[model samples]
Target: MSTLEIRDLHVSVETNDGPKPILRGVDLTVNSGETHAIMGPNGSGKSTLAYSIAGHPKYEVTSGSVTLDGEDVLAMSVDERARAGLFLAMQYPVEVPGVTVSNFLRTAKTAIDGKAPALRQWVGDVKTAMEDLRMDPEFAERNVNEGFSGGEKKRHEILQMELLKPKFAVLDETDSGLDVDALRVVSEGVNRVKGNSDIGVLLITHYTRILRYIHPDHVHVFIDGRVAEQGGPELAERLEESGYDRYLTARA
Candidate 1:
């Protein structure tokens, strides 16, 4: 089984003043077939942690290491880390003006699989994934996220995840800005992939609504860049009732 390990990770961002600390000694792990939910308020460095794992150049890993299936992920490039089976579905997916969804998916698939999926099979796979997400086939002809609604962008991200079939997925606030129906569609897409023994999910969110659909194996409360609390579904229920204030106060 595959594993994604985050070991006492410390991250910072370059600034005119020097470096600004973001993630402070955050540690977590997700194994194949498991779903781990990270919930916290804004500016808790949850997205920074996700970007760090995906090897985004903007976030600098000041200390600690990230590994995938025992391989040193910290030393790899963004594309390399992706090819090694790590996927990050961003909260704000960028708009590629001229890149059609089909082309983008094909390129990503080729990069991850080290081969080109046959034209007929590629088309079929994309169509199936789009249909599973309730997206129209014409979406493949449209440019990625250009003029699309927030919900559409989120659904597109899940579609990519389904097609790519990564070993571990870090979904960074995917439920944000989505309507109830859109949320259900995205959650269903995620659930469809969960049954695969080779996939593990790190679902980061600020609300418990998504968790009601995903049902995490473990839930972690991240406050001030560190994991302040850890529990099962009960923790999510508590957060739904009391919010993050109690945990933040205890951490303070």
Candidate 2:
């Protein structure tokens, strides 16, 4: 089984003042075929952890190591990390003007696989994935996220996860801005990807709503840039009722 391990990951972001510490000695591990939900209040460093693991330049790893199946992940470039089976669904997907969704997906697939996918087969796969995600067939022709709504952007993110078939997917607040129906649809898309492959999922969110549709095998509560508590699905249920008040108080 493939494993993604983060050991004492200390990360910081450069600000006007200087390097601002974000993640302080964070540690976590995810294995293929498992789903881990990270829940916490705002500014708890959830997104920083996600970006750091994805090799985002803004977050610098001051100390610690991230490894995927024994390979050093912190040393890899952003695109290199993708080819190594890592994917990040950004909290706010950026628009790619002039690049149609169809073209972008195919190009990304080609890059990851190191060769062009068979045109016929790739077309069929894209069609099926779109249908499964309840996306209109015409969506392929639209520029990526240019005129899409928040829900559409989130769906597009999951669509990439479905098509690219990464080994591990870090979804940062995918549930944000999604209405009930959109949320269900997006969660189902994520579940489809998980059910089809042995992909590991690290879902970061502030609420238990998405967990209702895509149940996590483990739940981690983040407070002040560290994992304050972790448990099974039951922990999520507890968070739903108690919120992060206890963790906040403890941090204080």
Candidate 3:
């Protein structure tokens, strides 16, 4: 089975003052077919960890290393990371004005696989994935996230995950802004992807609502850029009832 390993990772971002540290020595491992829930309060460096793994230019890895199946992940470029089977579903997906959803998905698939997919099969796959997400057929022709609602953008992200079938996915607060129905639909899409493949998942969220739908194999609580607690799914249930107040109090 494939494995993604992070060891003592420390990351920072450029601020007006100077480089400001965000992640502080995060260590974790995710194997294929495992789901790890990362829960934390706002500004706790959860998203920073996600972006750092995906090789976002804004988040610099100051020290430590990230490896995928023993290959160095921190050394690869963003697209190279993706080609290496890493995917990130952004918390706020950006709009791509000129790119249609259909074209974008196919192009990304081609880039990752190093081969253009057959037109008929690619079209069919996209159509099936969109349908599974309860998306309208016309959405295929729409420019990516241009004038789309927040829920629509999140659904599109899951749709990509389903179609691309990555080795690991870092979903950065994908359930945010989703209404109950939208959340259910999106959650089902994520579940469908997981059920069909041995895809590892690192789900970052603040609430336990999404956890109810997609149960994690492990749960991690982030406080002050460090994982303060680690446990099984029961930990998520405890966090739901207690919230992060205790953790925050301890950190203070």
Candidate 4:
């Protein structure tokens, strides 16, 4: 079984004022087939944790150990991380101006799988995944995330998760900018992956709405870059009712 572990993670970033600390000390573990939701207020370092795990160069790991099944994750490059079965659905997926979606997916798949996928089966798989996401078949020909709506871009992210089938997925604010219907679709796609694969999920979001569609096995409240509290789904219910005033007050 695959597991992702974050131990005493401390991360910082370069700002106008020089290296400012973001994640103070985060320690969390996600086992196979588990979904963990990280809920927090803005600037609480939720996104920092996600980006740090994905090895974004913008964030510096001051002191930490991030490992996947005892393998050193911090030592791997971005592509190496992908090939090693870690996935990050970015908060804002970038637009690849000239590359078509079809080409991009194939390339990514090839890079991760260590060889090119057979064209016929690969095309069929892409088509089926797009259809399942309710995307237009012609969208395969469009440039990645170019001229697409917010929902479409989010859907494309899920499409990647479904296709790539990573061991652990870090989704950063994926529910943002999605309408109710779009949220349901995206959540369903996530659930589909969870049910079909033994992958772990680290879902980072400020709101609990998406939790209704994709049930999290564990809920964590992130405050000032550290996990303040963790519990079962009931914690999310409490969060929905009381919001984060208590945590903010305590932090202040």
Model 3 per-residue lDDT tens digits across residues 1-252:
999999999999999999999999999999999999999999999999999999888998989999999999988998999999999999999999999998899999999999999999988888888888999999999999999999999999999999888999999999999999999999999999999999999999999999989989999999989999999999999998999999888877
Ten-residue region with minimum lDDT total, candidate 1:
192-201
**Better model by TM-score, 1 or 4?**
4
TM-score of candidate 1 to 2 decimals = 0.97
- Per-residue C-alpha lDDT of model 4 across residues 203-231, encoded as one tens digit per residue: 99999999999999999999988899999
Q: Tell me how far the alpha carbon of residue 162 in candidate 1 is from the true structure, in angstroms, after superposition.
A: 0.4
The per-residue C-alpha lDDT of model 2 at residue 38 equals: 95
Can you tell me which runs of candidate 2 are displaced by over 4 Å?
none
Candidate 2, 1-252: lDDT as tens digits: 899999999999999999999999988999999999999999999999999999888889999999999999988889999999999999999999999999999999999999999999999999999998899999999999999999999999999999999999999999999999999999999998988999999999999999999999999999989999999999999999999998888767
For candidate 4, the lDDT comes to: 0.94
Q: List the residue pairs that clash in candidate 4.
A: none
State the weakest 10-residue window (summed lDDT) of model 3.
243-252
lDDT of 3: 0.95
**Model 4, 35: alpha-carbon shift in Å?**
0.1
Clashes of each: 0, 0, 0, 0
